[model samples]
Target: MKYYPQLTKRQAVSALEEFLAERAPALERFRQALRADGRDPDTLLDGTTQGLVPLWGWVLSGLTGPDAPACTDPATVPHEDWPSWERFTAETEAILSYESVQLLDGFISYLVRVVEDRTPTAQWQIGQHPNKRYQFRNHPVLAGADRQIFFPGPVASSAREVVRGRRAPANDEMAGYAQAVIEALSAEETRHEPPEPLVEVEDLGDHPIRGREIEVSLREDIAHEYSRQVDHMVKTLAMEDGITRVIREDREVLLVATPSWNTTQLQEWVTQALRDAGNDHS
Candidate 1:
């Protein structure tokens, strides 16, 4: 999707209000249809309703493009010319069976997206070693699950300076201070230690253990060495179609299977482990 020009929070909010107002008549008609059909109008319009997608899409279409209104006073913008109420009602009546909550949810989700797109990703600077200009830009963290706008390539001391100067800087001023601190820290040539590696176990086999309970205990001496292996085995059992709960305490692991799990498979896995361990020792 083409990135729309960024808007300040206030502007974005005003634009959303205007967009909603343009669609108010049709949305109200949709609500009336729900009430007439013996559905609670208020209860039906929530985040999970499916009918809101097309409506949100229509709203977005108007907000994008070169001819799109500038982020000025909404009152000054010409009102969108909507289709007559009779025509709109006839078209929307076919989909009145869908829940209203999902439709509202779609609008909310799109609004959030529009606002975030305008949010500055980062602020930083440019220059030579000592007198560099500060800047800011968006950097991805948490595997892109989250993003923060701050000075790129900042050192520990500089980061500390940035943090110390402002416990929480205003949005507009954050970029410069963050970049300045990062540059100062970089000049100090601070050293950083590598992060610790994460240890995780993966499932090795599939079985239906959804609701069955089982416990296994390991000797303390071998717990560290075999914890990963044990964890993998437990996960395999837990993932079985009906397994519901898995609990671990020190060297012991417990599992609970729901009706969907196959207890026989659990038994077989345990027996196989015993045989494998015996063979290894022998």
Candidate 2:
């Protein structure tokens, strides 16, 4: 409802084209180096026509910037193990799950700076379309909230494939800002309208416990305590009657079917669980 001076969709798309064109030589060099390594650039399988751009972005700063992390202590780190800037790419977590996120995010970070430099007033964010269930952890569009821009990129498809494996909870704060973002992204990649938030319910029609027995079961389960994440989630989800917490394998776990659970609630619940577990005895 207020006027903004940052990039519009058309301008953002044009800017991406310009950025890619300027880096065309660098991109070509990248492909050639990959080919020489016997790694076919065509089959990079980054789930984009752009080919290996994610990897290139992951190592872009090291290859081109003064801030490369490879400038480590020479005696402690072997020269042979140091990153070869000439190659234009280096390894990180090579799996798609990590690739679509860290690798693509690195590239997106580069793009954001480029966008910022060009449009001084611009602010950008890279994240999922919460309304999207078949979504990736990192979608290709760089959202410029100030000017209703979604600077789309090759990062979308492959990232989606990775996200399809494990769905994360939607962020309410993000949703408050991103409804228009999905509209500007490719139709195939986003929902036309935001979907109503849904929660999972278990029938428990013929299960072993019911009525007062359920409350007794819950009280028995609560005796074995967990940690901060538990305290945090209990404070968060204690009023959601549809949910149940139980100890499994000596650990606190929620008993609802994952797909049917409140994605946000379960996400907060389990994330803390994992964090608590990982910190256990450490």
Candidate 3:
């Protein structure tokens, strides 16, 4: 699957500047109003900020609370846990997806830095006294696109359509339709995965950057730990004809699959190594 790349520090700074430019005029006007009343500029944006708990975090936790059955270890059971278990499972069955899990995790990391750098008093003041109220309610980016469609409960449009096509068979038919609807919605939920965080580092080597190869080196400590994990996973995979070599001169590790193996296999092996070392995201 194709992925989007993360912006570099310079790129991120540029994006931030653009973002501020769009919003700054109104914000500054509001700030002036606040300042007239002796409010701080820092306080203005602080109020507007979403703070430590990112919107994505709230959505994820609400969907799957720690105490929820899905979060609980299902192997160990107490009769009393069944109720919570069933509830959590039902919700999870409805909403669990690769994208959902990724978004929940990625946004938590993104929000931590955002919140730490923000000045709370400024954020509060900006939010309270903005020249125009910023209403993020129902914003598409804040919540996933499907948020409105399958809300409160899974959508039943397809099921309803199917029911209308046939002669409804009393309670049994309705129950079957309900089951079908649940399955369809669950499938749909997982169909849309969250966008992976993409990082585009400049390749310093030649050879056309073959099949997702990036010529880069990590910090010494991280590289050491990753080298160990990569070795371990490589053994577990038990595939011969592939060589894992640490190219100290290049300051990067290189995994080479002999020409006897197809490109697909080589890519998969390298991908697994990146994932195991948690450098896939890096």
Candidate 3 residue lDDT tens string, 1-282: 110123322333343343334333433443454465464546423422333223322333323323445454323444232222122223332323322332233332233224323322211111111112323111111122222211112112222233244322232332243334333433324445444222112332224443323232233444565667655554654455443222333223333323344444555655656676677653
Ranking by TM-score: 2, 3, 1
Model 3 residue 191 distance off true place after TM-score fit, in angstroms: 22
lDDT values for all models: 0.34, 0.34, 0.33
- Between candidates 2 and 3, name the one with more favorable lDDT: 2
Residue-level error in angstroms, candidate 1, position 244: 2.4
Model 1: per-residue Cα lDDT over 1-282, one tens digit each: 100112222232343344344355545665565576576656545422232333333322222222224423222333232222112112222211122222332333332222233333322211111111212111111011122222112222222233345323222232333333333433433434332212112122335543334444333334465666666666665666656666664553344444544445554554465345442221
C-alpha RMSD (angstroms) for model 2: 19.0
Per-residue lDDT, model 2, residue 61, is: 24
Best by TM-score: 2
